[model samples]
Structures are given as C-alpha cells and as structure tokens.
Target: MKLILIRHGETEGNLNGIYQGIKDYPLSEEGKLQNLKLKSKLENINVDKVYYSTMERAKKTADAIFDFSSSAIYFEENLSFNEINFGLWDGKDYKYISKNYSEQFQSFIDDFKIFKFPEGESFKDFYNRVSEGIRKIIKVSKEEDNIAIVAHGGTIRVILCELLGFNYEGFYKFNISHGCYSLLTVCKDSAVLEFLNK
Candidate 1:
C-alpha cells in the first residue's frame, strides 16, 4: 500500500503566519496557484481513498487533487486529522497570543506535548487522536490500496512522528510547506518514507 500525505494549500492565515486552529478560513488566490502546481505534479497518479480534514482549505486542496489525478478517489472528512484546536487562540496571531498568554505560551514552547491550551486541546491529546486515525487506516489497508490524506501541517507532523519513529517533541522540527506532499510505501510489516515535502 502507498500512502500520500499532503498539506493543504496556503490560506490567508498561513500567509500571515497566524495560529489558525479552526477558524474555517478558505484558501487565498495564491493558494489556488499552489494547489494547481501540486495537481499538475500528481497527474495520473493512482489513489484509492482520500481522507481529508473537514476544514475548507483542506477540502479545496483535495478537490484539486481529485480533479487532476486519474484515480477514482473516495473522499472522507476525518476530523481525526483536523488541525489542532487552538480554542481561544483560534484566528489570532501567534505573536499576539504570545504577548497575551505569555506564561502558558512559554510552557507550550518548552514542552508542547504536555502543555494544555486554556480552551484548546493539549498536544498529547492531538497526538492520540491522530494516532487512532492512523491505526485504523493501517488496519484497513488492502495489499494494493493507495491512500491519500489532505491535512494541516500539525496533523501531518504528528503522523510523521508515528510513521518515522520520532517523538512528539520533534513535531515542530520538520518543515512541511503548504501544497507539499510526502509519500510512504507501507506493508503489514513495515512502512518506508519515499519522499517528503515534494
């Protein structure tokens, strides 16, 4: 089985570098250009099912891929892979959030896995959610299944930590740009990373 993990195209929040937890921002015009490039790159690829975040940006990205790729893709909105719920911090600038909630934000910067958001989920909880989703996806993969996932950077980061044998603290260490994708070849025994940020 081959798993294609893609980060959604750019949004205004992304261009502005805000913490867009679940603000439901759609893609910007420039973002659609990025998706078009990705679609051109993935033309005629084989994909069995696509599980994407329910967020608008992710769905739009998925649509672009489905339109370009020749595969008959089955799409499912899995909240399990949604971006981290920033709760009170949603739709706010990171610098602003840092200025306001300096202490809590500092704690998050120190060790995010254990830090709980004032009105949001802890990184630990987010990790568990993604893990559960991956476990199920892996369990149901047939020998020739090819899957795709359109998700946020944070969602893909946690999934990489699980697939690449890394820890949660290193989640932010990886750089996954918008409209980029990572490929993995998986079997019942092992999973191999083919390429990342393509």
Candidate 2:
C-alpha cells in the first residue's frame, strides 16, 4: 500500500502564530492559493481512496484534490484522524501560552508524551489514534492501492513517527509544512519513507 499524506494549508491561526489544534479555523487566502497548487500537483495522479479530516481547513484541501482527482473521499475526523485538541490553548499564541502558563509550556516542551493539557488529551492518545487509523487504512487497502489522506500537521506527524520508528516525543524532529505532501510505501513486513515535508 502506498500512502500519500497531505497536510492542510495555512490558516488565520498560522498567520497570527496561534495554536489551532481543533479550533476550527478556515484556510487563509494564501492557503487557498497553496491548495490550488497542491491540486495541480495531484490532479493527474490515480488515487484509489481518499480520506480527510472533517475540519474545514483539511476538508477544503481535500476538496481541492477531489475536484481534480478521479476518486471520492472518506471522512476520518469522526474516526481516528482529527487534529490533536489543544483544549484551553486553542486559538492562543505561543507567546500567550509561554507567558501565562510558562510551566505548562515548558513541561510540554520537556515531555510532550506525558504532559497533559488542562482539558486536552495526552500525546499518547493522539499517537495511538493516528497509528490505528493508518493501520486500518492499510488493512482495508490492497497492496497495490494508492491512498490519499488530507489531515492536520500533528496527525501527519504521528503517522510518520509510527511508520518511521521515531518516538512520539520527537514529533518536533521533523516538519510537515502546510499544504505539503509526503509519500510512504507500506509492505507486509516493512515501511519505507519516500519523502517528507514536500
């Protein structure tokens, strides 16, 4: 199975340097243009199945691909591919979180896997969710199938971490640019990373 993971485009939260984990922000004008380019990039590719988050930003990105691709999409937000919920930090900028809650921020920086947001989920929950989602996708798809998934940065990171054998705490070690796509090949015994942050 070949997996194509496409991160959602930029958003107002991104322009303002705010945390957008589940805040429901839409794509910015620049993001729309990015999606246009992304659409053009994948317009001629053959996709067997498409999956996307329910969030508008991701959905819109998937819509662009759908408008140009030859396949329909399946929603994964209600299943296992939604963005990590930043909870109280949603819509807040790094400056605000660091200034108002320095200890929590530092704790998160220290140990992302264990640090729990005030009302948010731990990284473990999200990691497992993404891992399961990818496994399920692979399970349902044939080895020769090409699959596309439009999701958030965190979700993509988790999937890559699991596939690449990186720890969840090191999710920051790699970057997944907005509107960028990555390619992965999964065999019955091994997984190969073709490219990342593309």
Candidate 3:
C-alpha cells in the first residue's frame, strides 16, 4: 500500500501562529492557492481512497484532490485525524499562553510528552487514537491501494512517526509544511518513506 500524507493548507490561525487545535478554521486565500498547486501535482495520480480530518482546512484540501482525481472512490472525514486538542489554549498565541498560563506553559516546555492540556488530550492519548485510526485504515486497504490522508501538521507528523517507525519523541523532527505531502510505501510488516514534504 502507498500512503500519501498531506498537511492541509494554511488557515488564518496558521498564518498568525494561533493554536487552532480542534477549533475550526477555513483555508486562507494563500492556502487555497497552495492547495490548487498541490491538486495539480496530483492531477494524474490514481488514488483509491482519501481520509481527512474533519476540520475545515483539511476538508478543503482533501476536496481539491477528490475533485481532481477521477480514480478517487470516496473521501471520509475522521476525528482521529484532527489536530491535538489545545483545550483552553485553542485560538491563543504562544505569547499569550506563556504569559497567562505561565506555570503550565513551563511544564509543557519542560516535558511536553507527558503534559496534558487543560481539558484536552494528552500526547499519549492522541497518539493512541491516531494509531488506531491508521490500524483501521490498513486493515481494510489492499496491498496495492493508494491512500491519501489530509490532516493537520500535528496529525500528519504523528502519522509519519507511526508509519515510519520513528519514536513519538521525534515528532517535531518532521517538518510538515502547509499544503505539502509525503509518500510512504507500506507492507504488512514494514513501511518505507519514499519522499517527504514535497
């Protein structure tokens, strides 16, 4: 199987460096342009299925591919692919979070792997959810199927980590840019990264 992991185009929150998390935001004008470019890149590929985050940005990005690819059977929206919930931090800028929730912010900076957001998901929980989602997709997909996943940067990074056999601790090591996609070749027992952040 082949996995085309796509990060949705930029949203207003993304351009302004706001923590969007589960808060819904549509693609910005620039983001739409970026998606168009991505669409062109994938215009000729045959995709079996597409799975996207329910967030507006991801939906819009996925729509581009779905609309262009005649081979795409269908696209499904999955909450498991949503960005990590930021809870009270949603829509806040880093400066604001650092100043207002100083202690929590410090703890997050010190050890983010174990830091749970106020009323939001912990990293461990988020990883497990995403892993389960991937497992379900793999379970139903054929070995020759081409699958595309349109999601947030955080979600894409987690998917890459899970599929490429990277430690969760190296999550930030991947530079999943807006409107970019990576390709992975997967088998029953192993996966190989073909390309990244294209």
Among all candidates shown, the one with the greatest TM-score: 3
Per-residue C-alpha lDDT of model 1 across residues 59-156, encoded as one tens digit per residue? 99999878535456677899999999998888888889899999988998887879887888888998989988987998987879989999999999
lDDT: which candidate is best? 3
lDDT of 2 by residue, 50-140 (tens): 8887788888888876754433544344347889888899889988999989989999988788877769878888889889988888887
TM-score of each: 0.94, 0.93, 0.96
Question: Mind giving the per-residue lDDT tens digits that candidate 3 earns over 31-55?
Answer: 9988999988887878889999888
Clashing pairs in 1: none
Q: Which ten residues in a row have the lowest lDDT in candidate 3?
A: 65-74
Candidate 1: segments with Cα more than 4 A from true spot: 68-71
In candidate 1, position 152 carries an lDDT of 91
TM-score of 1: 0.94
What is residue 76's positional error in candidate 1, in angstroms?
1.0
Instruction: Give candidate 2 misplaced runs (Cα > 4 Å).
Output: 68-78
